[model samples]
Target: MHIAEGFLPVTHCVAWAAVATPFVAHGAVAVKKQLKAQPETKLLLAAAGAFSFVLSAIKIPSVTGSSSHPTGTALGAVLFKPPVMALLGTLVLFFQALLLAHGGITTLGANVFAMAIVGPWVAYGVWRASRGAGASMDLAVFLAALLGNLATYVVTATQLALAHHAQGLVQAWLTFMGLYAPTQVPIAVIEAIVTVLIVRALSKIAVPELQRLGFLPEPAQPVAQKVGI
Candidate 1:
């Protein structure tokens, strides 16, 4: 959900940009570490960027005369670290705004905060928590995707609330949440299912690639594979 320029007051835009600045800086540091550790990760980052660009551009019509698209941050976080995914997401949003006019330039910071930062960080946190619990790869992926999708809507609602507050609207936050929930909840469930299927397929055919990217668990006991086979 891209908030158009002029939709929010200048104060809110400045505030979000200020808050997001450190996140963008931390993302740069993470990208540097990833580059140092795996030189090939540059190519992977490029691919992720391209994939994110395409996925975000393909919008599905929604209520409110606006459209929604898969953030793709969860997928990237599952494949790489959240910081790197943030960078990829930022770049993708930048290009989407500049080239495609999919999102407004003035609201880029808000979009980055919501789709790039919130989604990836939530997904990463969920995945890490699940991993610590000895959850299966599929389960980890499912949880990450679920949280990511939900976080997107939450962030969007918060942004809309801020906008309404700036306009001196009554009960702005609650109103925004009520308006957006009807559309976002179903979309989140659909996205989670799609993410699970994609991750499951990748887990089966390209386990090594996932391992190299630090995305999947270490090989389970050999018997696990035999049972599936």
Candidate 2:
């Protein structure tokens, strides 16, 4: 959910910026630490970031004024964790502003909060929890990707409601959710399936890489079945 430039009130923009800054700082530090430990992952990191960037850019029109796209953060979050995704997501959003002219500078903080901070963390939580509960990789991946994208829109709706609602916050929240849920439901399913597909590919082509990233044990067997995206 890319928020257009100058759409949010100044106070909301400033508040969100202030809140998101520390997470970005932590993300950068975490990435540096990861690189120091696993230099081989540099290329993997690039590919993961590119996946998030490229998928999010293909927006599908939704509601009256906004559009939907796969956040694409869930896969990276599951592999690399949420902090690095936050850092990479910030750069992705900034690049989208500069190149695609989708989300804007003014609203970067809010967008980052939704897509980077909350989305990844939620997805990662679901992933870990599901895995801990002995869920299948496919099921964990699907839940992570699906719920993460939904969380992004939920947070965005909350931000919008807080900033612009003439009605009370609850009412505004409900309104925005109603507006986004229709298209977002299908989009979430599509994004989750795509994420599973990508992870399945990585598991096959990059088994060693996945082992190094702690996504799989060194002796793990392949689990990719015929999955429809």
Which candidate has the top score in TM-score?
A: 2
Candidate 2: tens digits of C-alpha lDDT, residues 1-229 = 7887988998888999999999999999999999999998888898889999998998998865568888999988999999999999999999999899989999999999999999999999999999999999999999999999999999999998998788888999998888888788999999999999999999998888889998998684445533422
Cα misplacement distance, residue 228 of candidate 1 (Å): 32
Top lDDT model: 2
Q: Which regions of candidate 1 are displaced past 4 Å?
A: 166-170, 217-229
Work out the TM-score per prediction: 0.84, 0.94
What is candidate 1's lDDT per residue for 1-229, written digit by digit as tens?
Answer: 6777788778887887887778888888888888798776566666566756776677777676656666767878878867877777788888888888877787888888888898989998999899889998778878888789778777887888767785555577677766656666676666777777877776687667677787766776788677986
lDDT of 2: 0.92
Number of backbone clashes in candidate 2: 0
